[model samples]
Target: MNLKTYQAQTMAQALAAVRRELGKDAVILHTRTFRKGGFLGLGSKNVVEITATSGVNVLHPTEKRELLNPSSVRRNSHTQMERKISPMPPRSALEPSGPAGRDHSESISSTNRSVSSKDYLQQELKLVKQMVQELLQQNRKQQHPSVPEELFSAYMGLINQEVTRELANEVIEKVRSQLGPSQIMDDIKVRELVAETLTKMLPAAEPITLETTGKSKIIALVGPTGVGKTTTIAKLAANFKLRENKAVGLITIDTYRIAAVDQLRTYANIINVPLRVVLSPEELRQAIDSMPNMDLILIDTAGRSQNDDLKLHELKSFLHAAAPDEIHLVLSTTANQSVLLSTIKRFSSLNIDHIIFTKLDEAVGVGMLFGVMKKLNRAVSYITTGQNVPEDIEPGSVGRLARMIVHPQKGSEISDDNIPSIAAGEIL
Candidate 1:
């Protein structure tokens, strides 16, 4: 039994050698290729290594039987025994399998390799892919362009009507530069822009806040559904009652939804404030006018769909009855960028003075913030994070908003130092 190395320019030549010396039962140990380095006119030569193991013990029974113990054989038997040996063809005399077999084998190997690669990448590339995808999404959302929406959309034929990052940024920056120094626009620079944009859309609030100085204020919170209007109103209520010592009254214009009034009523209970459920605009007006001894009036409007002009206008009739002194437009930063913009536009005509940016934590890109303030010229009064009553709401200004937009690289939860690494140069 012996192990031998065979070198050949092609696999067929090497395999033939193995089959010839070790027969059809022979097993291939290993195969590899090496190439020299070269450039331009230089050509690198290729070399192959084939390890072949041949032994009667591990081979066919015929080969094993051919081996006999010399000690058991007599010296005269070699001359006396004249056995006729059969002649057989060797592998060096046979033809190769040709190129078609080689190509078919390679195709089968490639298909199997691709399936294996999927499993390998899924296990090893999870974090790396997540990081790259996050970054790519961020870049696509942030780089706004200044061209007109129609022109920009025409150039690219995007199905999503919202302005792309390239176009949005271009327009926002152009207008921002024109804005005089008085406008405090940080990264969410869009706040100031939105203020400017909305100013043209909405008429001035009909300056008639029914201010009853010393008495408890019956304030109602109102807006379309899921804008965090009810929750924001609660926060405002807590701030007024606890911080300002203003006796606050709660009223809901959201009797249409089953738990709408119940939700606000629960808030009223938490703050130890009394709440009124008004089903009609007339009742809504009557309830607020009746609370004449109240200091501030916060009215809650039903969540109206932006597309429902009739319903929104109908709701406005109720709001118009009370003549809200400070109408805050509560916009969610996590909302679709187009929806947020349209809501601000639609609500502007209804006498919205200030905007509240909710769910900033849920927002990954500040482009909408920039769009609302700088591009649209809207004023933001505060930002609310989580749903936790007063604990989650904060008075947001340009400084904090700017910091969030400018520096977006947040630290990873896993410490870099804690990650294990292979020893230097210890690679596969």
Candidate 2:
């Protein structure tokens, strides 16, 4: 194929010119705008440039056809790109020609070479994708998969289902331990494996219960901004009240996030539970002690960044003041595994008892959770699947959690639109 240049002031004009001269199927090798060139006409100044390369199957002899010819195709050639090609063979030769004995042999050899090259690329792509998946899986194993099944599954679903392959066999060729198929490309099986992986990543659910049921234990739900801490708190409170028939008290220290207090207070009112918003550690202490008759006190703290030492310090102070019997660290499944692991480690010093995975009805990616639960050596207590109060929260059961892990997404392909957020909201 001859290299042709299309020049026009407007990109559309340039494209039009290319199409008009080279025909619709012509390959666009390159496109550019040069501001450093001519004064006028043939010479233009620097301007916007749009470059694109496209190719088409050649029916008749062409340069690309020459390169694609089989006789010149080297048997040892690792890449099709390296093969020397002759112009496209005549249509007659494409069909079997017993008459050309030796020529026929060469044609068969050429066809085999091309086919082999294609197969290699495809296998390579599969290996590459598997490699990425395996890397993520390894991380989840290291961290231990304590994240709520839904969140992890959904995050992973995005990765697996939403991404588009721009090039031939790139992702398909990746080597990953995560992708050994029980049966290749079966969406149901893929979902099952992904779900299984998520379930494996999570630590066993170890329910935290106070031996003395005469009074309920005080628990604090804490995490970064937008992690559904407040909603989770509401769910937990409702769980204790409705399920256990225990008198639940709600405490909100989430003064930072927008409407943290009001949001929690609203939920409290809906559930007819008493709600108190405290800012200072002293007030928090007073709030805890004021409800001595309460069966259980669930404190919701402000959402703070993991790196914010000051915010963490303040939270620690509140925990000390309230003297919560348990601290459930709530983290999203979609957060970067490494960063989330570090955050959990940081919070471990505060003596967090159980882990709660909120927003389970979100993204998929069990591999991320692998790093979380394993590293902390902790068990999950509860998982919140959706935003619905009381109803969305469930005692962490392996079976139910498994369903949310990857069922919703299989071969769905992940994209930016399908990913999840890791922020926490105020618990009110």
Candidate 3:
């Protein structure tokens, strides 16, 4: 391998110099920019530098010879196969004339080495081919050619918002396809179309209400640890019982953490609602039956680690006993996209009806939530912005969430301030 460095005023010039010296097959090792020819760190000129290498020897002599001479290689392979099947006669029995015998032994030894090298080369070649195929496939699926500057801004905005590249591309492509040339020329119109398309992609369910005419609704909050499940439940409890004037009861099976139980108990006391702490699945059943007259029973579960299958299954057993009407899989908006997906997959054993995203206020970017909602295909019911009870929670809306993800500067446009507040006397 030969390595060389080139410096020029611009990247194009530096790249050209590298290619001219190193050839088209050159591999770029590094690139950097620096200021030079300046006195006292003033009036410095910027220069682009590139380090490149070429003539890298990748193949062994034996492998190259075998690749170029297929007939001789195949003949040698056949001879090897026959030798393996039928062992060679003893040296004393098959000994040839002195010089010829030595030559035959050396030829056999060389052929053995060649065969071993061939096997190794075949494996390496297979791996290289697989890598090339994968790279080609990825290239095919990568984003299309650059769009006009106006459209490119929208595309990059989505990416900056943490939206998946594939999804962002799809959104841009959809907008491009639907709009006419005249419409496309207007950046505002194009951006609005993109936002509208993203908003429509998010599905939201009706808010859980205890005032319904149907049978008493039982809702369970489940999620991985530190996702704000207990706090979210407290918010929901306050909204339903204190704010909605409906009979609401609380049940918690999160005995694993003493703090968790105390937290829910504190919320129940503040909200003036009956609270039950059960130990086992049978106890959970009893807790459900004991709260028959309650308009709604909000169950708070322990925040189990998604990777702990045993604990998750145990949690599922409790859920099986209660058989709640709604299982709200609580997730934190600040969580990494991969962790959120793992949590969802782990908790999927129990039926999930709605998704509750908490800590939206703390999230740097909520665009990953778009991918999560789309991939899970579960409707979002509520999104909690802050720690304030009942104040920070809002009924999930497709338009609100989509707008937040696509254009985060616009605060959640869905209004909850005017939502009717319930009378305290009704809870007693």
- Which prediction has the highest lDDT against the true structure? 3
Model 2, global lDDT: 0.59
Encode model 2's per-residue lDDT on 1-428: one tens digit a residue: 45556555554565566566655444333334445466555664544232222343433334334444444444434334222221222221122222222122244335533554355346657999999999988896565354332234434453443222121012222212355554434556555554455455456575546436577578898887888888988887787777677788999888875678889988998888898888899999898888877878889988878888888998898888888888899987656666678889778878888788776567455434534665677777776778888777655544344553344333122222322211111110
RMSD of 2: 18.8
Q: 70, model 2: CA deviation in Å?
A: 17
| Candidate 2 worst ten-residue window by lDDT | 419-428
Off by over 4 Å in 3: 1-143, 146-150, 411-428
Between candidates 1 and 3, the lDDT winner: 3
Per-residue CA lDDT of candidate 3, range 172-272, in tens?
88888898889887877876788788876667445775545746789999998888888988887888776677788999999988888898999999999
lDDT of 1 at 112: 24
- In model 3, the worst 10-residue window by lDDT is 85-94
State each model's CA lDDT, in order. 0.54, 0.59, 0.72
Which segments of model 1 are wrong by more than 4 Å? 1-222, 411-428
